[model samples]
Target: DSNNDLNDSEQEMVDIEYMGNNNDTDSLGEYDDTEVNVAGNESDDNDKLSETFDSLDEEQLLFDNGDNDTDDDEFMDDWTTDVIQSDCEIVCEQNMILVVLKKCRGLISMIKRSTILTLYFDAQRKRFKKALNLCYDVKSRWNSTYCMVNSFIVLREIIENLFSNKHQLHITQQQVKKLTNFELTSADWHVLLVLFSILKPFYLVTTAMSGRQYPSIGLAYYLLARLRNFLQQHNKKESLLEKRLKQLLLKKFLNYFDDENEQMELIMLHAYFDPAGFAALTEIERRSVEQTIKKSVADQASHSSISVANTLSITTTTANSENKPNANRNVKRNAMNLFNEFVGDIQYGENRENESKRAAIINEFYQYRKYVIEFNEKHEPDAGSVIVFWRTYGETFSILKGIAKKMLSTPATSVPSESCFSTSSALARKERARLSGEHPCSSVFLKDKIKL
Candidate 1:
């Protein structure tokens, strides 16, 4: 009905133009006054009608004319240019998109939001659906996948809001079906795999924790079995064999080895013989092993050395025992010589005001001198006794000496495990240049890599 009305309106405008040209206004003006006046009114009405029709024509011209071949070309050119310009803008602003992605990376919820926004902007409805489905799959496996799931829902809502009123622009189910069937590119698949890799350790941790008894050794065995199965499925025979050897070595150490208490030795053995098998140890166990090793070293050093004292002694020989006076005089002279030498080397003091402190110092020196004298007296007959003492007590003395040597050689005390944790933290935040102070669920995914 509207089409017919439009056609009739167009036809009426054409007829009015034809009649105006045929009936000259000048000739009509020269006729009788009554006739002239009526013709003048008709001309005025025609002029007003012509203006209205011109306006109508302008409005109709806004819609592309299907019948005109030339107009079709122009319409297509405009549409193509608009599309190309829009696509170019999208391409040009790709760096901005990357920046946004990086900025939103810290928080899991933010990452999810940004991903949805990117999908919406790209108009990838099918890809969006597939992403949502992936999130659902993850959630089905574990409810913690809610972050990704909520992101997908938010994206869907955004799409609906943007196109709800524009029926022609709406994303259809057919388009979504087509997109859902689209195969992921190799790079996309790799990214998904990396994400899965990140999640797997967390899954293992949760699974282990959920059990009635903490079966750490069993969990390790189960993990090893799973890895073997995966390797076999992938036809990785060499890797599977290597892993199997490591597991066997681990079983031998855990089941048959007697050094359970020597945790550092055990850790060293694991590092040397069964690198993969040591994953069975819990966090607490690992820490305990490290502390035990340090303490053992300290205790061994403490127990190894004997405390000894330094002393000096003197002896005198007398000649002519029958000549009592001369012999006595010679003995007295020898004793005097020894006393003078001893008094010159040793100093004893007393302070009336701080008598206790002075006495303590004197007593310590006296005890040391007495031990030295006794030791010298006992060994005076044997020249080889010094060598014998050194050889016999060498190990004990070396152990004592090692205490100071070790203290000096060791670097400033710092937890290497804690340093590793800080490094891991830095790696996690590299995608996010600034801290939002929000915790990420993906942090759990990094636990395996951060074991002490």
Candidate 2:
């Protein structure tokens, strides 16, 4: 009876969920099989779908709700229907903007147009002497895209007026026909300018991050933090588009940073250990980094102890001593007791180590800061010279020197590797194609050693 009651209650709940509070007998009837039948034969389903599609009219196919207040005539004029002569091309209207820009790419290739623009600029050199020259973007260099867009924006007025002299510019009849629908307007230029401004900082950031001479690892967290802050600041910008772009960029950066932070604990340790970078971190952050380093040291010491114990046990067996079993057991017990003592010693040593490390960190930090004050330092210490300082004065601050050496030895970016690849590519060019096989390695070594 209990099970039956439970079943009835479940059935009533299911009915309530699906049927709601319906009072009509027709609504209470079983649901029709008119809904898509996934279990039906594939061919029959396809036929039914095709029939349904055939029944759809132009009105039914369109999704326009007639709420848009944009002037249809002005929109039609802006986006020419030369490519597809249809009034129903509004679905891909957003994409049509990019399509127009892509078509305008050919305008950059016309020699006559280029010559005229150069001549015009030369004639008006007094007023627009600093005007940027027209340039095309290279596929291999993304920075060139910004340069291209910026140049276009700088010469927007001249370009717009250039259309009046289209015939004198020697634009052929076919070229004119092709470029008819691809003309950029004042509003388009404004949008391009906004985009270029948004991307300007990224170009600068890329150049900064690619620095080969500096200890970029120490600057990594600082640079990324600044970029995050910059993006957040832009999130408060007036333009909704700019704000949305910044939000997306910030989200992506946060996700990347969260992932990299886990992998760069050692890098942060090295950063904290850097005297030049010492001032950049707060006291709390410095303490956290010191604790992380201490934990890593403890882990290494533990592993080493375990390996040493195993080696000693193996050596004892190999010696084949003629000691009695009780004596052997006693030795074993003594060894076990010694191990326990060693563990206790490690625990006690850690407390002392913590105190000593804390003192050392504070002393180095203050000493460096004081030295900078005495010298009236303008810039931080030379990043490239850090390793040299460690090598020369390593005896004075042995622990810090070791840390500096480790940090300096590690390349902060894959730029060196990329530079090598670029060198190899240069060596393998059409004229020097066979040179790569001869002495590419030697060439790279020489190239790296030569101080420009």
Q: Best TM-score goes to which candidate?
A: 2
TM-score of each: 0.20, 0.53
Task: Give, for candidate 2, the lowest lDDT window spanning 10 residues.
Answer: 12-21
Give Cα-based local distance difference scores for all models. 0.34, 0.50
Candidate 2 lDDT by residue in tens digits, 1-452: 54344323322211111121223223322222112233455465345434434432311212121112112211122333323334453334335435534534544433212222233333332233333455555433446667667766766665665555444332235445534544676666655766677668777766665766555466555555557677889534357656665675576667656457666565566566444555556677777886775565556656665676668767876666544455565554568787876774344544565567667756755554454343325445445534544444457664555555666555567885678788778866854555656566655566677798
Using alpha carbons, what is the TM-score of model 2?
A: 0.53
